[model samples]
Target chain A: MDYFLVSFFLIQYIRTSLQTAVNHPEWEKRLVFARYFSIAWIATFYIAEEPFWTNWVWDIFLVWLIVVIYRNEVFNSLRTTAQTVMPFVAISIIRDFVKGIFPKFYEENDSFFQVAVAFAFVLCFFVWFYARKQMKVLQKEREDRLREEQASRAQKESLEYLVNERTQELTMQKEELQRTIEELKSTQNQLIQSEKMASLGELTAGIAHEIQNPLNFVNNFSEVSAELCTELEEEIEKSELAEEDKDYIKQIIADLNQNQQKITHHGKRADSIVKGMLQHSRLSSGEKEPVEINALADEYMRLAYHGLRAKDKEFNAALVTDFDDTIGKVNVLPQDLGRVFLNLFTNAFYAVAEKKRKLAAEGFSSDYKPEVKISTKKFANKLYIRVTDNGTGMPEHVKAKIFQPFFTTKPTGQGTGLGLSMSYDIITNGHGGVLDVESIPGERTEFRITIPVSEPISQS
Target chain B: MKILVVDDEEDVKSLFEQKFRKEIRSGQFQFSFSFSGEEALTYLAAHPSEVVMILSDINMPGMSGIELLKTIRRDHPSAPPQVMMITAYGDSANHDQAMQLGADDFLTKPVNFVELKEKLLTIL
Candidate 1:
């Protein structure tokens, strides 16, 4: 029986020590010492048949637990270390007390204790295995949750990047759309301006055609009448008329000649105006030809004045020109440049006419003379032409948008609203020049045209 | 010399007669008046040998001056009578086309009668 007890205790000690070593690898040497001590005490309890030495087993196991706690440093706080060690110490002391009191009963029920120990060992092994499986499941769930969180964060970042890119793209597209709208507006204005010019040209061309026939007849009849008058005078001289009668015939012939001269002069003036209108209406041939700039400006200025006079018999203004004769011949499309000058002159005349009418209405006859002055200069490889009117000058607002197409301040039918805009285009865009305006309210308005001396490298 | 004045305007006939009244009275020249191109053609056909010169306006009723010129050039290809074209439009295109159609001279109105008389003397 004692050998059986010795063998059983030795096996339990070896198994427990092996479990400790397996649970904590750093406690391997200490657990081995504890195993030998347990075996020696169990052998003493069995061989000496004494209960006192068996009490040493509980005390030695308590010491071994302390050694495990110190060597592993498993508990971070003293209270936790005490809590972990106190349970085993209490159970071991109780077991030692029971053994001390039931020494004789222990010897008789040794198989009962061995059966309880074996059952306890089986229960502990089962509990340890179940706990290990539960811990593995929990660890796997946490890892999966972490992976899911990281993937979602990455997805959120990608979505944010895509949204930012879309916003930038939209902003860029909006800017492009704005630019396109601006370009379209400019193109539309140009088209409207061209259309207006085209129809006006067609209308003027028809009128010119109709008027030329009558003008030709008037000129022809005047020449014929003048010739007949001379012939009649010669006949009177040959017929031996009285001195008084001859003198009367000569006087009548001279008067007739003067009337014919007036008719011829006015007819030529009308013809020139018709020609100017035709020139304005016709399409520019875009052929560069030599032009006398100052002479051309003066001619158009006179024509504009005469044109207004034909319309309003009472309308008159002082016309002045300071021409630079040195600007003899510049290469330009004569019809186009002529149209520009005609438009400027007409505007000046209209402004002066308006001011004159106003002054006449107010009855302020203190010599508020309406005057238009044209001047030209050539310097620094450029030709500068200026047209000034001392009439009702434009305000700041009117001067600001004077070049925009279809923007006009004149009473509806009196202006086509395209004169200055077309003139601006002709000088600036067509000739690669600059058109500038300087005006003061109720004082004066001046339009300046600056053209480069050299021709542009490209036509378009 | 016999000359034919073809014009749509009736006054041109009297004007021409009045202008050359001295020459006509002296028997230096003879003038025939036709109101239209077809009338001029008919006159020419009736007195082909009598008509030495034809002055026609390019813009006219019935047959145009260009057509008349072409017809004269085509039918009388050999030693044809001199034909001069007159137009109110001074555009070069019409002048060129008229000259191309075998007109002897081109003039734009209002015609210079003195220059025309000089040209007529040269031609005769």
Candidate 2:
């Protein structure tokens, strides 16, 4: 009986210790020492012929060791340990009950008790094996759930990264599309403006042709009438008339002569206007010629001044010119360059004239001499032409939009608004030159044109 | 010298006559007038070699001055009359076309009569 008890206790100890070792690997060595010590203790108790009750003491110590090793899981460990020892405890109770009920039967069938104890041990071992299998199933389920969570987190992070990359690409494409749209809008505007200019040019050409013929007649007849008046005076002097009559005829002739002079003056003005219109309507001929630049500049300056004078007879400004004698000739589109010079000179003269008018109106008596100055200089490979005027200069906003088509400061019907813009195009696009402007409001404004002195190789 | 002045305007004849009255009265020169390029061409065909110079306006009815100039150059190649092309449009294109079509001179309108007389005398 004692040996059976010792064997059952030893099996329980080994099973519990292995379970504890699995739960806490850091206690594995301690558990191994405890196992060997219990075995030695059981052997010593057996060899010394100690009482069977002493084995109970060793079982209690093993339970205490399990409690110490699984401190936080003491109740769970105790339950498992109890399950391991339950069958043995139940078999012992059944044996004691049977022995108490029939003392002689129990004394004669001692081997039956031993067989019953062995059967209980086999059943306990099977129960422990089944429980261990269940634990392994629960552990596998936990590991699978943890692995699935990690995989899902990784997938979520990658999805976020992809979303960010796509968003960045979309933003860049949107910006590029916006820029292209702006470019398209500007190009469309330019097309519309050029179309308008083309139609205007055609209309001007027709008007110029229709007007020039009659203008020629007016000019011719006026001069012929003036000559006839002179001849009539000569005839009247030779006539035998009273001195008062001769003087009266002479005075009439003089008045007629004055009228004829006025007619001729205005007619010439109208003729020049027609000429300017023809020049404007006739686009550049795309022919480059070696022209005397100084002579061209001087001619346009006088033309601009006279054009203005014809309108407002009292309007006058001092015209100053500093021509570069060294710049003898330049290969350029003479008509186009001449148009640019005329536009600059006209703008300068108009500015000074405006300032002069304003000063006179305000009765500002200061010696504010409204002046328009033109200067030409020749550098190594470039020719610079500057037109400066001390006049009512523009502010920042006006200067900013000066080169834009149809942006004009002059009153309606007085300005076509295309002069400076067309001049800008002629200087930059037509001649491959630079046109720059600088101004101080209420003080002065200067426009500078820089062009290559030599003919471009492509033209040659 | 007999010069033919071609124009679409009818008043041109009177203007020329009055402007050159001294020359005409003195019998220094004679001026004839044609209202259109076709009429000028017909006059030239009828009075071949009689005209010393032909002053034709470029923009006229029935036929253009350039076309008339081409015809004159083609038909009277040996001793074609001096043809001067007058245009209101003083553009280089017209000038170039007139020059290319054998025009002796090209003038822009509101013609300076003084300059025209000098040119006529030089040509004669």
Candidate 3:
């Protein structure tokens, strides 16, 4: 009976140890060794006929092995083990106490005690099974939650990357569209300007023709009348008349002569203006010829100066020129280049004249001497022409648009606004040159033209 | 020398008459006036070989001086009268066209009477 009792206890210990090894695969080897040790201790107990204290020592050793196996969850595993074994342990102690108290009754009901022990073992097995099922459910829930979080984080990262990529593509497309729009706008402006120039040319030609005919009549008639007056004076001198009457007739003829002179002077002025208009209307032949740049520049400078003076008698500005003598002649379209120079000179004079007028209005004209300067230089296969003016210079905004067609600082009807724009085209497109302007507000303004000396001029 | 003056402006007749008064009085040159290119053509047809020179103004109504010169060159290739073109526009295009069409001379207005007189004397 004693061997059976020890064997039943050893079987229970081995089953629990194997259950722990199965539950924790990582602790399998240690748990298996513990099972063997428990079995060996039970064998020692039987072979040595050890006292009951030896059985207690083996039970403590088995509990210590369980504690070691569940080291990370020692208290939880201890409580679970206690819950599983407590009923069995309490039932065994009660049986031992009953047997001691009533030896004859315990012997008569030994079978009942065996049934109670088996019932306790079944209860402990159910408790252990329930606790393992609860642990499995908890572990499964935690793993599912972690997987879901990882999947959502990956999706969010992918979505963010897609958004950034789309934003970059949109920005690039917007920039391209803006560039195309700017190109279209510039092309449209160029077309409008060319059309305007064409119509203006025709108008100028018609007006010049009509005005030149009448101007010719005025000039010829005045000249003829002046000659007739001289002939009449000779006739009156030869005639026999009173000295006082002769003097009176002579004074009348003199006044008439002076009147004809004035008419002739104004008529010639009108003639020149008409010629200038015709020149403007004439189309360029697009022929490059060798021309003295200095002489051409000087002529246009005088023309621009006289043109301004004719409009405003009081308008005057000092004109200075520094020509590069070594640059004797350069190949260029003379008329087109002359037009560029005339435009630049006219703009310079206008700037200085405006400044002078403003200063005069402010009573500061006495100290201010309005000046326009033009200079030329030659350096290593390039020619430079600069026109500078001491005037009310332009601000940044105004200077930026000065070369745009129809952009002008002058009041309406005073400027056509095409002078500089056309000049810029002629120098750059026609002659393969560069035109640039620099200005400081309230100080000075300068326009510089750079052209390759030996560049073969294209017919633009 | 008989010179036919062709112009659109009617006032041109009086102006020319006055300007060449001395020459007209002295009979050194005889001047015939026509207000249009058609009238000049008619005059030339009526008095063929009588008119020695045509001082024609370009840019006239109905027929331009270039057309007139072309017509004269074609009609009287053997004995084409001297045709001088006068224009307000002294552009090289017209000048070159006139010269190419057998124009005797090209002059720009306002015409210098002194230079014209000298040129006429040289022609004479």
Candidate 4:
């Protein structure tokens, strides 16, 4: 490249030297500048320059220079071109009429200054081209960084949203669970209260029955005493004079005996009622023994009938019994099972008594008396005792709840409301038997208690 | 008729002892009592025909009144006392069993004198 540039500048100098006789002084000074400048410019002008002849000559020279030179630099075409073309122009004029590719002769015969300016112009072009490419690469990197930052921000926002939703759902579930717990607690409390009330009701019923017993005795004895007095007065009023009153004395004696028997009978019933209440309502200290069904049924039926009559003195319900002669004996606590029978009798009487009352109010007389029919039927393994009453029977609803605790169709205070509930407990729970009812409204109500007559109730 | 009142409660016996003392002294009727079912059985075994009617408590510590009645019915059905089971427990299971055991009648506790007199009249 330096040789080419020197040749180029020599041509230019020749053109100038041949320019119609320029002065010797101008030529000499111009020759000195052109000779070394061209060589120097050509030596360094390899990056942006294309060649006119044997293009690799300057590359060989550049290789030598690069091997020895320790210049740290970017590709600065303008500086390289000036460094290479400077010596070419200077050497061109000093060489003895050398012919080379400066081509100022054909390159519009431009002056040496114009050629140097063109080399500098090409250097500027390469620098600008590379600078634009570097700026484009930096822009692409910045765009990718923005996209990554945006994606991270989107992910963080979505995660926060999910956390918020899940927290709200958990809180709602906790509230529902707490509400269910509260409801369960309230239900348990209600059950406890119901049990306490049931026990209390049983206590009160016992007390009422006991108090009524003594009242019964007092009433009967007093009446008997009055009747005896009247009879004595009648005996005194009988005339026929005192001579042979011996036979008459026997008559008075018999009447006196009858009245005495009545007095004793009434007094004993009152005593027995008190005894029964004391026994049943107090501590359970009765002996468990094998008892005969016929006797037990008869006695409990009478006791239970009296209990019902004690409540309503005007009640006049007839009792009918059809005992099974085959059933033998059963082992049980007489007091407990006796109470169950008593309750059944009382309930039957209530049902019949109600019918009687209603019938009487509707103008029916004693022609159609209410009857409580108690019958026993023996089956394979158990004995069935049915107590039925001709009464205003239960409706479907009442029948369904009849065995539930404290359920009653009677007037509020007239019943402890535990009669059927406790009866169910005794017959079913205590005896391991079934207490069932069949009823038809305005017709009859029947309660059938099927119990194992041969089995020990204690095991039950 | 002579009456035998059998019960476990002292008050029941005492009430009768007091109420019937006058009539007993006058030779109108005989009235007696035994606390336990065993004693009642012992008394009845000796005085079988003496007892025209027996008022017995259904519940007792040993040998309940119903059991005594059963023995009476089995051993001496013809001369047996007309038993009336008196009790407080008004449950149907025992009442049904008692009546089924040959008990002539039943009486619940806290008794009414009027009803008792009528029932006695019917039995007599």
The numbered model that scores best in TM-score is 3
| Model 3: per-residue Cα lDDT at residue A53 | 51
Instruction: Write the residue-wise lDDT of candidate 1 on A1-460 in tens digits.
Output: 2222332343344345346457655555655665566567666777888656555565665555555445554423223333433444445454555667887887787676656545544444455456548768987999999999999999999999999999999999999999999767756765676677677779889999789778877877777777788888888889878999899989999999889888988988998878776666667877777788888898889888998999999888999989886777887778888888988989998988888788788998468888999999988779999999988889899999889887777854566578888898888878899999999877788999999889423322
Error (Å) of candidate 2 at residue A307 is: 11
Selected candidate, larger lDDT, 3 vs 4: 3
Instruction: Report the lDDT tens digits of candidate 2 across residue range A288-395.
Output: 888888899998999899999999998878999999887877888889988898899999998998888888899993788989999999887898999999999999
Write down the TM-score for model 3. 0.57
Candidate 4 chain A lDDT trough over 10 residues, lowest sum: A68-77
Question: What is the descending DockQ order?
Answer: 2, 3, 1, 4
lDDT (Cα) of model 3: 0.82
> Compared with the true structure, what per-residue lDDT tens digits does model 4 show for residues A1-460?
3355434543353444335135445545544554454465565455446443433444344333332222423212224433543443333332212225445553554455446545543443454445547657987888898899899989988998998899899999999999999756655554555566558758755775657655655654555555555565566567565745745775666677677667767766766655555556554454557767767878888887887778778878787999887765776567677777787888788888888788889997567778888898778878788888888888999899888765667754556566778778877766778999999998899998887756533322
User: What does the lDDT read for residue A237 in candidate 4?
Assistant: 61
Clashing pairs in 3: none
Off by over 4 Å in 2: A1-157, A194-207, A235-253, A280-460, B1-3, B24-30, B42-53, B70-84, B89-106, B118-124
Task: State how far residue A418 of model 2 sits from its true place (Å).
Answer: 12
Candidate 3 regions off by >4 Å?
A1-194, A288-292, A298-320, A324-332, A342-372, A378-384, A388-460, B73-80
Chain B structural similarity (TM-score) per candidate: 0.97, 0.97, 0.98, 0.87
Error of 1 at A435 (Å): 2.6
> Given candidate 3, what's the lDDT at residue A206?
90
Candidate 4 lDDT over B22-53, as tens digits, reads 55677665778889988988897888688888
Docking class of 3: medium
